[model samples]
Target: MHGTVFPPIEPSEVISTFFFIVLLFGSFMTVVIANRFIPAVINVSFVKGYSVICLFIAIWEMISFSELVNPVLLPPASRVASMLVFLWSIGFLQSQIYATLYKLAYAFSLALASGVTLGVMISYYSNVFSFIESFATAARVIPAPAWLALSILWFGIGSASAIFIIWLGCFFPIFLNTVAGVAKVEPVQVETIKTFGGDKWDVLLDVVLPTAYHHILTGSRIGLGIGWITVVTAELASPDAGGGLGWMIMDSRVLLDITSVLCGVSAIGFLGVVTDSLLNSLEELVQTWG
Candidate 1:
């Protein structure tokens, strides 16, 4: 099957694969060594975390080389890694990454702004919460993919449609967390603010936001993760919106290009880790502010 699917691996391919392995483990060993000597080298957690990753890659290569699975279905780690390098070299990866991130940024921004705003309003106003709570609950029960057709219909198969779907996926988690955050703010603190001749705005600014910063950041992280997943789904469904990593995956699937599919999937996974790490850093920073 491998022979029929991919041309026979040439000598250059073997050499390339050999160097890819050396580079991969060389980088890992470098980091591991640095972690041993450098106190400032990425904390113990990252070092330990990456060790597990390296182990997984080693296991993956073993299984692939042993032909434990069909190579066509589960390509070798080396091939996938090389494919990633190849895609990046050709600029395809960057363009698709930009497209996906572009849609994600717009959708996530909208979700953050509107979610925080409405969440604050609902938390403060019983009437507003009463009116919207049921509707939000109902909408939240529906999966993000269910909105694909409707979004495309409303926005017409383009970036707008993709953005709307991502926003929908992101909004509820953020809104709920924000409301919870505000609700958790102590009545004593609020009352104290009022006793000090503070108005509602002063209470909101001084007591509510500061108390809710942690929760809001938590929500943003969760929403960003959901937004990332939703953006891929949106792009997969809205091919007319132009190129994106998800679109690239679906397109590759059509051509039975498993390597390309893996490349896209790997890119998404890498980006997810990077974004989550960044948000985690922000969350930690926000905790310090408290």
Candidate 2:
């Protein structure tokens, strides 16, 4: 019942398991904490709103399993928690997560650089914009699995191919957004800068980019999400995929380990949500004009 329930998880990892559990609920729980602790809280009504949803989920799950829903397909939350605790102790959690994050980081960086450049070109050049609009439509429409196949063929079955597929998934939206952000730069701002003798490059640096930074950040945020989606696709088609979270989930499915699958899914989802929220917060913080 301790940490031993997971892939060699042990009792030594119980604290980490508890911390992770706290973290999983922390954002919503912050409402409860603040309402009870903070004085002069005006929006306290919304503070505990998410907690109701959480409680409802817990009750629903309880009733679901009590009504004889197969535990194998939908493992009890208690069992899932226990398994996570076990895995926490065995270093299983760290290794698998690190694997997925490593791949995603590589893909994200590539997407940021390539997407921004392509977006800037498309935004500024009418012909390029028209040409890329079609490409963006097609890329978004194409199933990721198809890209997985093409990536494998083009780059072979490893991180490089995985990174390519991830980039493909995220690239178009980011590029499009970058173009929009750049285009949204105010004409007056540009005119004013020019009247003051600012050059084109000066306008881009001081005005265009600053104005577009929020949109660019939004694109990057969305791109990060797409990168998360592509990891699953990459693992399935990847030649060298086996140890990471995606591969682990695939392996768990193959072996019919529902608890491990749940853990993997939870970790993947948790990381994505946390990262996106951080980026969103940063975007708000850095937004100067708005």
Candidate 3:
């Protein structure tokens, strides 16, 4: 039963696997060392939290690979690590990463710009907001996946389709949040600007925008996550059009390469962490400046 469930690993591969494990441990140690020198509360907390998650994942993988569970369905962490190296060595990994990142950047930028602009306009005009509110509410109920077919028909399978899906999924949250934030801006502030001989433009720029900045940032964070999910789903739906992490996961599943699938999942998860952290840092910087 053990032989059938857990195939033998080559000695060289085992040695290399141990080396990889040691490298991970060393990296964790390096983070701990850096944490000691870092004075910022947020930075230290983030490092510690990240380290704990990594450690938990490592332990989980170790236990899963110990023959306590079926290895066929859940390959060892070492196998996934090796698959990652192989993908990188063959130049597929970086290209796919670039493709996904490019689409994400483009779609997220469009959503942010359009959402914020339209939201501000809608908030300023009661008639416009009244006209659009029902449609926006209905659209929010429809899943992003539901638009893939129409997007494919309109954009004809490629980045265009994926971007449209991403933008569609991300836009609502940002737009709604922006409207809420603008509406919540203290009326007294606007009145004060008016009393100072400021025009509507000045009230918007000086009072409304700054007050709503935090809300906009919050919406952006939420929209970014939704955009990432939408892009991956879009890529999976149209794998032939573009190579991305999602495509890699789908291809691995087709080939029955569970290790490769796991690697792709890990890559996506890691990238999400990095992107979220960067955005959080940006939020902190903005808060300080404001």
Candidate 4:
């Protein structure tokens, strides 16, 4: 029997490959321009590091497609690039992105509101703190995935379940950090406020809250990260409810389409970086105001 032979690459495949190369080149050039002309406005080191990582990955993908590595198990970067383009063209990727972000926003907002409020109450009243601290500690120790079964049972396989998972993942960090920050507010500051004829409400609003803002921001950063992870996990577990990046990943895995899986992973990582940077900027502004 003749050995199996692959067909020659088509013109469209060549064009797609060229487009991918151009895309990478453009990204590299953008980084170079930013570093050289806008050094003070950007994180030059981070941009450089990211460019190097992308270059390394592109080279590795080229090597893989040359048959040095098993492309069947780890699809080449060109394949991933084509898959991303296809997803974007179909509008499915955008919808999934929106769904995930919408759930994250809702869950994180709920976490912020409840966490801060309860945290302040706990910090102010010894009785409330005593009643809740042990429970909060226990909840914090449990992994987010541990609650998935119960969340699914209660909320079913949909946005409600995903949001609940994200909320649980985000809540404890914010709560704990706020409690710590409020507790650390100097007694002298509170006394000074009281001496100025301020009541408990005024003291809380004028002193404790402002002092704890930094810590609360830190908690929010941590919670956002956790929420991102939890939402993806929940979507992966319940892909049929609301198609998301995680659902795309699971579907790709089932088909052994490693390229699509990688694309999904990249999308998640990119979103995380963007969101974290925005939060960091907001934190800086808050710090300046404080």
Candidate 5:
């Protein structure tokens, strides 16, 4: 009963969620239309012609699997819609989304801070960068679940473990990107700045650093993504955090709750898409400046 309240299956609420989802998707379509379709119609560029294609996919998912999917194993889209509608009516929709976001926030904050600081230092100082880069490479190659156990040992079984897992999971991409960005700064730009009485920070600010902004941003974005992935595992491994999306997923699986599983999957994917889009916007801004 507490489980029902804790990680409720509100696939019913997804019906109302259409207001948010469809409107957002419509905005994306508007862009595709503006960027690709409109120009092509004016004989400027080739149209993507894929929005309608995706719509067709929705149609096929509803029709093709409606009766084919067993209720226990794979609920119909209609059922998932019903569950969404149910959840939305109770006002638990936003909370459901928040559950996942909470874990991500804890994980990303640490990884970004560590990665950027270390990356900048390494980029400017070759010796320091080599040592840090070597360690980051080792950490990245290690299995994430193993680190979750280690984190639990160090930080208990709740947010601490989850945060540590996420931190370790995302550290590599950000660190590597930062180092690469620092190392790849244009030599001529550094010289140009140096010739103008620029000190280390001035050269970095005016010349060397700007060149690597794109790479740095890319690393940070990837780190955020990996952190999300790691939190799911961490939550499962940590007994006390039996309230996160990962735990919610673990519980749903125990009860054979396919719709809830799908719901969690959808929510995570939604967040990921939103996050990537925001990062891309930042990257574009950096490029404009760079």
Candidate 6:
């Protein structure tokens, strides 16, 4: 009887794997050394957050080593990390990330521009809003993902479809927030501007936009979060997303490569965290400006 044969690993792969192993071990050691020197490090919010991550990794490692669950279903964290490193080394991961970000950027930019414009029009001209309100309400009632089928039909199974889905997901929150912000501006402020010889431009520049800026940003942040989720969903469903983390996950799943799937998931999580942090910083900056 012939036993199953495995492909020979390349020397470069061996070197890369060894390097990643050393990095992982060095990271763990650094954490341990830091813990020894700074017992109160965990008291800091950032450190506490990382501690939770470490705890999760520790639990996952234990579960993998203990074989309490099928390894195929839940691969070890090390394997996932190594897979991520290997993919990055091959430049495949970077291309996927770029594709996803490019689609997201186009979608969210369109949503922001149109949402804010329509929101302003709606806020200023109640008649226009009255005409559009019912339709808007009906559309908003439907979830973003529900539009996937129609998006694919309309735009076909490519990045266009994914962009449409993300735009749909991001538009409503931004529109609603802009309307709410504009509406919240006191009528007295508008009157005051007009009474002081201010034109419509003055009302818009001095009162409306400044008042609504924070709300718009808040809505943008919410919309962006939704966009990320929608983009991933679209990529998973639409085969012609070109390439993306979502596509990577789907491909890995089909091949039963759980480690690559986890790597994709980790990439998404890392991107989410980074983007949210940047948005938070922007929000704070706006607050300070105000």
lDDT of each: 0.84, 0.73, 0.83, 0.83, 0.67, 0.83
| Residue 76 lDDT (model 2) | 61
- Give the per-residue lDDT digits (tens) of candidate 1, residues 92-185: 8999999999988888989999999999998888674587888989999897878899888898877888888889999999999999899899
lDDT of 2 by residue, 210-256 (tens): 87787889888877877787887677545375458888777777777
* Cα lDDT for residue 81, candidate 3: 77
lDDT (Cα, 0-100) at 171 in candidate 3: 94
State in Å the error of residue 180, model 5. 1.2
Best by lDDT: 1
Q: Candidate 3, clashing residue pairs?
A: none
Candidate 2, superposed: residue stretches over 4 Å from native: 1-34, 39-50, 64-67, 127-137, 237-239, 288-290
- Candidate 1 weakest lDDT stretch, 10 residues: 7-16
Off by over 4 Å in 1: 1-3, 7-15
The predicted structure with the larger lDDT, 1 or 4, is: 1
**Candidate 4 lDDT (Cα, 0 to 1):** 0.83
- Report model 4's TM-score to 2 decimal places: 0.89
RMSD of each: 2.8, 5.0, 3.7, 3.5, 5.6, 3.6
lDDT of 5 by residue, 9-125 (tens): 444333433454465467556766676646654332322344554465356345535556544565655456566566556766567567667767766777788877877876667
**Poorly placed runs, candidate 6 (over 4 Å):** 1-43
User: Which pairs of residues collide in model 4?
Assistant: none
State the TM-score for model 1. 0.91
How do the candidates rank by TM-score, highest first? Answer: 1, 4, 6, 3, 2, 5
Worst 10 residues of 2 by lDDT: 8-17
lDDT of 2: 0.73
RMSD of model 6, in Å?
3.6
